[model samples]
Target chain A: MSDTRTSAGVDNFAVSKKMFTWQVEGERSITILTAGNLATTQSLISLLDERSVSGEERDPSILHQPTMFQVARLVGATLREIIIGASETGQTSADQFGASIIVGGQIKGGKPTVFLVYPEGNFIEITEDTPYFQIGETKYGKPIIVRAYDPKMDFADAIKLLLVSFDSTVKSNLSVGLPFDLQIYETDSFTSDRSKRIQADDPIYQAIATGWGDALRDAFQKLPSYKV
Target chain B: MSDTRTSAGVDNFAVSKKMFTWQVEGERSITILTAGNLATTQSLISLLDERSVSGEERDPSILHQPTMFQVARLVGATLREIIIGASETGQTSADQFGASIIVGGQIKGGKPTVFLVYPEGNFIEITEDTPYFQIGETKYGKPIIVRAYDPKMDFADAIKLLLVSFDSTVKSNLSVGLPFDLQIYETDSFTSDRSKRIQADDPIYQAIATGWGDALRDAFQKLPSYKV
Candidate 1:
């Protein structure tokens, strides 16, 4: 989300870039959606990019990793390293450099998966019990997903559900905004199956946001009112 | 809200008490709904209570305030003082002392009003533009209120709206639990018009929670799906 709104002391509008995708196509692919501390995230991504193209022998880039777990570890380690460097002076940078990433995709023989990597270099994968992972400004949009999530739901439905989630977040938090970068990966296909950056005026996103709000009002009215 | 669920290291369950009411009958009245840290708020409330009943000079309780603005200032000052005191002692009570309060009611010959007091000792009163205030675990339930709130809404409808808001919050956050404390003050009557604690087994609350979920799922299904 873009930070189109802000209060007095806090601003997240500087960030419009929170999603990144890397793939070797037909082999393995990863998509990283980030939140928090732009400088730290940028540094982390640049370092990974440099290592990927540098052909350096001493260090292994995320692309060279064998599995999703390895990719998580590499990203986690790099994040910790960047944070440590940023915070070397004191707690200021440590606080300022905190970042989180959602690393998702599939490696060659593995099923498609998603993970939430924390600032501390530790991470957890989304399980069958919890099919989706969201980080940063997540609460406002959570209830819809909580009520509506289904493992068997089709990708189109999944996209609609997420748009509602993101729409809810965007409505409530000034820090999150459109256009949102969305990517889809098909199981066994080691590449981004589809992707789009939904702009603020995008027809589909507008429909979803307005439609969801209307639906909520309609739903609220339909509920049996508490007899006071 | 209560904490029935928690992740690895976060807990907001310390608060089962979030509603406080003060009324002098036909003269004046106020109800303060709090969210955020426990100790600081407890201290703030205790200070107000202490001053209210004390027979001392150099003290002005929240009741002594001439206007709701003054009342907001008093509460905000108390909150800021508590936070500063806690922070100064280096983690003794500071880390757990952050708090926020919503002060609302009517004063004799004055219009009914609401103010959201921040931890920083500042507050913004509710205006025609936004008729309600919510603090702590507020996001999950906000969209509903945003859609349903109306300045001209009857008190009965207002209560139902809030229940839905609280219901959404309770569903998404285990920290916000059942048996919620509620107080309603009629505009001219001053003193609390009505109050109730919706218990875990409260049939009405249960129905609302379950019905809301059902309504939401129904609403989601009704929305036009994306044509992928």
Candidate 2:
């Protein structure tokens, strides 16, 4: 899942897509979530897409990577190329070109997995012990996930957990907001379930957001009051 | 209230005091909370103390600042002086000497108030609309405060609220932990109640910490599950 809000400054936020998906029927599926400088991330996504569809190219494309590891490296290398290219023109410092990405999905021979790719062109794969990666405005939302995550939980439960996490972040931060883009890819499915763009007025989201506040207040009151 | 855990790096954290108070019976009471570069903050505190007790100095000290606003400015100016001095000595960049402070208290003629002092020698007073300021590791703890804060809440309820906020932060962050320094100064009283340093194994602290987790999980579970 990814939030659609992006901003150049605190006061000027616009809805912008930050998730990209690629699927080859019965073969592989890939989903990418991005956070950081809008221009840099957009450029990275465009380049990845162009390379995948471009014919007669010597450069390896994300679609052709043999493993998820290679796909993550490709994304990182592409990020570095974009940063170095911008730096060479002296348009901005390489540091200003930073972006973070979470890439995940099934790729034929590989089981479903996710990788957190850094701006420095390195990545770490998700593990059972740490099965999730969050890229932006993460702190407010993290406590719930850390406390509630279960590897055995169903996707519906996972989505509820995420909505609660997202609700917390959305309420606390101005930079993250609705509508959120969500997709679910079961292992070996090679294609996602009907992806969702949950808008601001979505009933379920409103329920979760408003319901959570009341529920939390009730829980807080139930806790023993602090004694002097 | 302020946490005692301080860290030079993620792997090396030590218990250190970050709250300072000055109380003069039936006259004035002040509390200062510090967050950021430990060495710089320590130096800032020492300098403020020295200037206050120097006896023959012309410069106004924290103890002598006539108003809470002036105290905030003094703290900001001292921080700027420390950063500039460090820069001039070629010890480190001015940016590395950054620190943030929250100063609050009641003076002889003024109503009780709080101010957030920035590293750049500027500050803003808290108002009814935004009655609290948090300096470091603030995000995880902020949502609770934003949700539950009530100016009319009694001192005990306020402390309970703060403990809940602190509990959320300590659970989420490695660099913030018990024991916490707490002081309560009632308006027009000009004297604080007995302060407490809540240690990790303190019974009340333990009960709240463990109890909050259980309460949160129960609250989360009770929220309506997401519908497909």
Candidate 3:
């Protein structure tokens, strides 16, 4: 899942998709959620798409990577290349071109997996103990996920959990806003049909946003008050 | 209320009080919560205390500031003095000597009030619409406060709300930890007996920490799941 709100400054924001998905029928699927310099992220994604379509016959692309880890590596390498290239031009420091990515999905023989790729081109796979990754204004939304996460949660519950988290973040932070883009990739199923964009006026999103606040207040009230 | 955990670096944490309080017999009371470079904050508080004790009889001290805003101004001036003094010495930049403070309580003839003093010696008072201020590690703990704050809440519930906020922060960030110091000042009462240090093993704190997690999970389960 990714939020569509892209910000250039505290007072400047626009709706833009930050998620890119590539799938080849039932053979393979990959999804990337990006957060960072919009220019760098867009260029990196375009490079990946262009390479997958026009790479030298012997020079394999992300679609040709055998495992999820290789796919993450390819993404990271491409990001590092863009940043390094920008730095070499003397226009901006490498830091200004920094970007982070969360790459997930299944490819042929490998099971569904997720990896967090840092700006420096290194990556870490998500484990059962730490099942999710978030970037760009994360702290306000973290406590809920830390408290409520369960690996056994079904897709419905997982999406609910994320929306609640995003609602909390959006309420507390101005930079992150509504119209969240959501995609649910089922294990071993290389399909892209379960994706949807949650607009600000979406009834279900509104209900969850309003309902979670009331539910939290109700829960807070049930906790024993501190004694004087 | 102030959390006692202080950090010099991510791995270097120690128990240190960050809250200072002053009160006069049935006449006035004041409290200051600080967060920043420990040396700067400590020195700033020390200056406040020293000046209050040794200033010329007619010079007037924080105890004689007449209003919470003046006290805030006094605190901010003291902080600026310390930072400016250090900057003048050429030992560190002004930013390195920066600190922030939250000053709250009642002075004689003044209603209970709170002011946030920035390092540059400016301040803002909290109003009915924005009833609270947090100085450090704010974002991880902000959502709960934003959702649950109420001016009409009794002191006990207010303390419960704060503990829950602190608990959420301590759980999510390593730089913040247990053993919180709490002080409750009643309006116009001018007494300071209602203070306690919440130790790591304190049963009530333990219960709130454990119970809040369970309560949050319960609340999460109660939220309506998103339909696919």
Candidate topping lDDT: 3
TM per prediction? 0.91, 0.96, 0.92
Which stretches in model 3 have alpha-carbon errors above 4 Å? Answer: A57-60, A87-93, B56-60, B84-96
Task: After superposing candidate 2 on the true structure, give the runs of residues whose Cα lies further than 4 Å from its correct spot.
Answer: A90-92, B90-92
Q: Which candidate achieves the best DockQ against the true structure?
A: 3
Local accuracy by lDDT, each model: 0.77, 0.85, 0.88
Listed per model in order, the count of residue pairs whose N, CA or C atoms clash below 3 Å is 8, 0, 0
Task: Kindly report which residue stretches of model 1 are placed more than 4 angstroms away from their true locations once superposed.
Answer: A1-15, A91-93, B1-15, B91-96
- What digit string (tens of lDDT, one per residue) describes model 1 on residues B1-228? 222222223543333466778878678888887767666777888898898889466888877788888888898998998899889968565546778888888778688898999888999988778767777777898877777787887776676777888777877876776677767666688877677776768777677778888888888887767654
lDDT of 3 at B226: 83
Per-residue CA lDDT of candidate 3, range A1-228, in tens? 788888888778898899999999988889999999999999998999998998676655898888999999999899999989889989867999899999999988889999999999999998878989997778999999989889999889999999989998999988888789999888778987799988999988988899888988988998888887
Each model's fraction of native contacts: 0.62, 0.58, 0.76
Ranking by DockQ: 3, 2, 1
Q: Which ten-residue region of model 2 chain A has the weakest summed lDDT?
A: A219-228
lDDT per residue (tens digit) for residues A31-120 in model 2: 999998888899999999988898436877888888888899999999988877777888767888788999998889889999999888
Deviation of model 2 at A201, angstroms? 0.8
Cα lDDT, model 1, residue A2: 24
